[model samples]
Target chain A: MREGTGLPAVDLGTTEMLEPGTALLIPTETSGYQEDIGLFRAETGSYYALDDECPHEVASLSEGWIEGEEIECPLHSSRFCLPDGRVLCLPAVRDARTHRIEVREDRVLLYPGTAATRT
Target chain B: MSIESILVIGGGLAGFTVAQNLRARGYAGALSIIDPAGIPYDRPPLSKAYLLGQKDTAGIALAPAEWYAEHRVELIRGTVRKLDTEYLGVELADGRRVHADRLVLATGGSPRPLPIPGGDLETVLALRNKEDADVLREKTTPGMRLVIVGAGLIGAEVASSARTLGAEVTLIDPVDPPLVPAVGQALARRLHAMHLDAGITLVHGTPVDISKTTHGHSLILDDGRSIDCDEVLVGIGIVPNTALAQAAGLETENGMLVDENQRTSNPLIYAVGDMARTRNPDGSLERRGEHWEYAMNTGATAAAAILEQELPVHGASWFWSDRHGTHVEGVGDMNGVGATVLRLAGEDPIAAFHLAEDGRMLGAASIDGGLTIRAARRIIDRGIIVPPESLADPGIALKKLAR
Candidate 1:
């Protein structure tokens, strides 16, 4: 049993649906947040969650390409550091809001509204 | 030569980027940006979000007011009267002479005025900056009849935004379906078709004249057909602000001619963004790029060159436009010689990919397919050859092919 942070942890289902180096879009209803959450699994097997919307324009970050620990927004190519949601490029100066994510025993757990701090 | 102080003219994205990158690259020199508009704000949103009242002036600002103060960048509010190349500075229109060790010109461009009669009327509008957007926004009202001249990016965007604001928009253009060179014919057709669907009257004719009417304005097409509208907006294109560059004797054709490092004929001065046209080593002048990303890229290149640092590698030219609640993105040279492989979703064409004769990807354009365009940009940049079958298949993910 993983220690909970006292916040509501929504089980995003088995990691089978979210393979390594892929991203899964958790809808607003599932995340219980106003905006959708983007759940990304890096090739290194690290899971990170961020707001699905790109800060620049009306773009879904979940549809963006993932390279290493950065997610490049498909629209305008504004890249964000996956771990801390730091903006890595121009056209987008605002940092994206990141959510905490933990994967235990193939079960992906997402803490909605919890800030993902750089470990 | 030690560049102790740097002066940048124009406060658009290009000028702001040069100043921003200078600070980012740890050049703690006396940096100052002079512009008629004090702060640097984004222009792309001026046509869509800003005009539609979705984004405020602050929202479209390149950086907050505190950013300049924090970065020690002095923002000067004034226009440049003359470029003093000998003094390596500028004379402000207000008669203030400011000197710096290095001078950067990012003067950007002004809206291309209509050549017909009544085209230059004060009532006729054009959107290029925040002030222009504000005026357009104020004039746009429900049931207002608006006629936009030019069906290009800005014209089309204003048409879409005006329609959203409950205005009856009539978009007139010389070409039946414009922007074929930007996004290719297939995507251009689809994008132009959206105007009709959005209740905008698309006029396929050239405007010969604009005359004031009793109620509003009347635009006479080449065929003598007239369009009556409450407001007229001209979004044809832009004329580069090269007066300062020309007066200083820096090479200028369509725009200020700059070398690979963004250095003009005079090494002390540099030019970037829409007003700076790159001159190839073989003496061929590249077209001046007016896109937002191109401005930032040129700014970055100028900054690196100024700091004696390695220039940042830029990928294929990319641009995006939002209209009718749909996002369109294009990358690379879509007009190049290639076969277009279109990915369709049922009856709708979602993505179009241009593949070269040698199997390499030349360019791509998509409607509401940002990811597809992003992947195609990577493929084009990396010189990756993708199978046309896989590119056309909607089932196969574009990301997979990029890898």
Candidate 2:
């Protein structure tokens, strides 16, 4: 058994639901959190998670375009690095909050309220 | 010569971006921003979120006080009397002189006054800065009759926001549906029709005169129609503030003339933001960009030029406006001569794209289609030749074509 971080890990369905270079939103009710969570799969077949809300406005990051390891906010074009949620552009000075995601044998699991382990 | 200290006039987005980019690029020399407004805040929200009471003064600030202190950027609150180019310094209105090795002019534009009778009335309002928005917000009350002239971006946004505040808004414009040049005719028509749905009365006429009335004001139109309202807002456009540049012997034609690097006629001085117009190598002046993104882009370019670093490359021009609970974004040249392809969903225009004869995407505009616009920007930047059928088909996601 893997050592637990005390927080509940949510199975976000199968990895097949999220193809390479695509993203999906985990609603607040499903994530058991107040804010929605965005799970993105880069073209390199890596998974990263972040708060769905763009730090600049009320836009959902899940709807944003994903290029490489950065996600460009649909509104105002503010880009955030997927791994650490660092702001890569202007109009948004604050960095977004990132969450941890793990793909355990084709099953995607989300550790809500936990910081993403930097790769 | 190495730049030891830099001074920027006008603490708007352009000036703030210059300072911000300078620090980000590791230029640790002395930097300062001087403006009549003490702190730099965003202006786009002034006619929308800030006016609607959704955001406070602190919310619109470009950066917090701590950021300025941490970055060691001095924020000076003063008005510039004149530019002492010989000494590479500025003379404040209070008789104080601040010297710097390099000078940047980001003095943005001022609201263009209506050129008609009683147009300059004290009660006639214009939204440019925070104080203007605060005053407009205070006057915008429930059931108050408000008449806004010029249904452009700012006027339309204010009308929508005022209606949300329960005010009776009447918007006036010369054109049937304004902003055809910015967002194309189809998208502009869709956006303009939203005013009626939101309970804003649209008036297609020019105001010939504005007279003070007992109850409020009477705006006389060229068609001999008069609109009586408690308050009036004129948002036609802005006149670039080029007086300082003209007095300092810099090239000024409608705006301060600058090269591709944002450098003015005088090598020691540079200008950015709305006040600076690019003069091509052939001596033709390009249209001055007055949008927020253009200001930020020019500031970044100016910072790099000042530090002798490689200039940052910016893509096509982009702008966005919010009204009637809908977000409209457009990128590149929407007015280019080409065929227009519109993507509609159940009779509503979700996105409209312009394509050249060779199928190259020229420009695109969309309502509540942020993802579509983002993809369109990439397609335009990369010069992607997408078929018209795929662009018009709502079933086919634009993101796929962008790849």
Candidate 2, residues B1-403: lDDT per residue as tens digits?
7778999999999999999999999999999999998989989989998998888988888988899999999999999989988989899999999999999999999999999999999889999999999999999999999999999999999999999999999999999889998888888999999999999999999999998899899999999999999999999999999898788888899999999999999998999999999999999889999999999999999999999899999988899998887999999888777889999998988899999888899999999986898889899999988999999999998999998
For model 2, the docking class works out as: medium
Predicted model with the maximum TM-score: 2
Going through the candidates in order, their DockQ values are: 0.65, 0.64
Q: lDDT of candidate 1 vs native?
A: 0.90
> Where does the lowest 10-residue lDDT sum fall in candidate 1 chain B?
B330-339
lDDT of 2 by residue, A39-104 (tens): 999877889999999988889999889998899998888999999999987778788888888889
lDDT of 1 by residue, B1-403 (tens): 7889999999899999999999999999899999998889988899988888888988988988998999999999998999998888999989999999989999999999999899999999998988888999999999999999999999999999999999999998889789989887777888899999999998999998998988889988899898888999999999999998898888899999999999999998999999999999999989899999999999999999999999999999989998898889888887778788999899788888888899999889899885888889889999998989999899998988998
Tell me the lDDT of model 2 at B336: 74
**Candidate 1's residue-wise lDDT over A1-119, tens digit each?**
22333348999988776767779899988878777999998777689999899988878888888888889987778899999999988778798888898878988899988888667
- Deviation in angstroms for B149 in model 2? 0.4
True-vs-predicted CA distance for residue B371, candidate 2, Å: 0.9
- Colliding residue pairs in candidate 2: none
